[model samples]
Target: MQHNLGVIGLGHWFGWLEKGVGEKGSLKLVKAVGTKPFEDKAKLLTGFGITKDRYYISDPDGKIPEEFFEGLDLVHISDPNKFHKAQAIESLEYGKRVIVEKTLAINEREFEEMKSFLKKKGMEDRIYLHLHYLHKQPTLALAREMPGLVAKYGKITSIEANFFEPVNEEDPRRTWLLAPENGGIFMDWVHTSEIIFRMTKCSFGGIKKASDFGVNTDYDSVNPTGVETVVEVSGSSYENGALATMRMAKGTEKALANKTLRIVFKSGFSVFACFPGHEAEFNNAGARGTLKILDAKGKEISSESLSGQNSSEIFISEILDFCDGKRVGLNLDEITEIFKSQWEYQRTAGTRRLITDRESIDAFLRNGASYTYCK
Candidate 1:
């Protein structure tokens, strides 16, 4: 059975979310809930989309009445951080699976409370997270192939990486990047999923760890000040003003290309085999073997290339997977746990309330405590 979805927050990225997700490809919109009442509801979302059945809520505290979520299967929440935990908890209680926006909550304290609420209601399993595109996160994509990639060459001795991109000057200017209660950069980046890749997925050997100061959002503001944060995870550091470095062999395709990358882990030696001046498009995503110890000296290691389905599609394919019998590996409990640990790390390092704070979500988390992967 296709899941009937109710897209609550219809904002700029609403279109992107509709296009890039679940059963929406075939199911009905079921309902659309926005912050405004039916009148302004349609107005705020003008020009984008507003189906007939989709209604609006004028007062910020309005609800769909009793049993409003009776038949809905899923609810995607893209509201501001301040309203997320509350709205999401309600949706889950009403029996709607949830995919909340980043940070999950304004503070770490709420992160715990919301999920705990669901666990107590026997709805924790139904509560899910749907986050937007995570920037600069190709790190784990590389790690997935580590086992096979390393087998042919040699054990990975050392790895290095540097990830940095200027804030979308235009996008943030129009969104939440400006508010502190909305959880400035630290809340969005450090306390959320972006850092999950660093915590559990990537494998690197770096000695120093550091975090950079957060830059003022009103960069164009006259006496601007920014938050400076330093955190060490997975052997790497974060520096705001300086270039990041990961000391692994530049021997792979996804590793740093522009900066210095030298990988010398038993595979003779490989230096960004896909560097622009070298191989082009096909060579772009797949790993390249610079020097493998497989054949005799002077023998160039063969370049491997392949592509097909993405994991998101695979993850989604498992949706009705639970309909009949449970399938293995279709779920991401371990992956989610790895991600939760990073959230805990962020809560400890920065001043914020975590998901563990909410009494309800705290119970929600306990249920998962034993569902870890067997591998």
Candidate 2:
């Protein structure tokens, strides 16, 4: 059965989601609501059966129209961070299954409201949080093999994950992110904490904001003060003694392309997983990720490229299963744990200094920096 999909915000990711709907996929894109008309982009989407009439401009208030949800079986919320809770609740109120982007909500109050509203509607299983990283390989493969790896090695002692993106001078998304009300970089990159929680089953004890490197002056002339572009966070596992560190950056010319997760064990061995390039993954190609087992001395003992579906396909598959009435994706309990961890981090760290000078930007990018693919 083809499940109709209505998109609340046609931002950068919806294009990739469109690709995930392969010729015979179960989902279909019928109606969409964006802040603007998106003229040039509409030409491309018409091939997928979406016409000009299908694209509706959002109201200034950000409430989606009832007519838009009338015939939809599911709704995808890709709006700005602040709008997630309202749009998600509206979708549920209309009896539409929902797939939302990360950070569930900006704060605990909003999250609880969403939780309460969904439960009231009795559509808890109809919602899913699209944490694409969880579906990516070496993520899935490593998570599946964690127990065996722990048995062979010892218990995990620490985990380090890093995600960095080269600055795009022309990308308007960077400008949109500068508004403090938009949730800034912390809400965007909190998924790193989720990755840690999923693997260790430990909530973050406390998150310390190590540094915040905002956009460079020359790159973003509009906001000279800039918003957070790069940040380093360290936290210990709540239950287990394991430690986790994450560094996330965006909109910096000095930044390099890096996405990886490294898990170290007590027995003097570690496993490092490297994800595929973003373009390949978004293209719906069978992007392959690699996992390398290294000895304590950093000697590579074994390595293999694990092949699997990209995040887009994996997310679509899960949502389709959900539409079929099978329980999948994160449950309310899992969502609560992840949301609480993220909220604690945001409350404790807040926002740090805005790095405007070249010296500090270089310093923040020094450790855990990668140059494999520069932009």
Best by TM-score: 2
Q: Tens digits of per-residue lDDT for model 2 on 227-277?
A: 222222233322155666677766545435567778888887888888775
In terms of lDDT, model 2 sits at 0.69
**How much lDDT does each candidate structure score?**
0.41, 0.69
Candidate 2 collision pairs: none
Instruction: Encode model 1's per-residue lDDT on 178-258: one tens digit a residue.
Output: 355555444434322332343234322222432323222233232112222222333222112222222111111221123
lDDT comparing candidate 1 with the true structure: 0.41
Task: Candidate 1: list runs displaced more than 4 Å.
Answer: 21-25, 36-49, 58-70, 131-143, 152-170, 173-175, 187-210, 214-306, 309-375
**Best of the candidates, lDDT:** 2
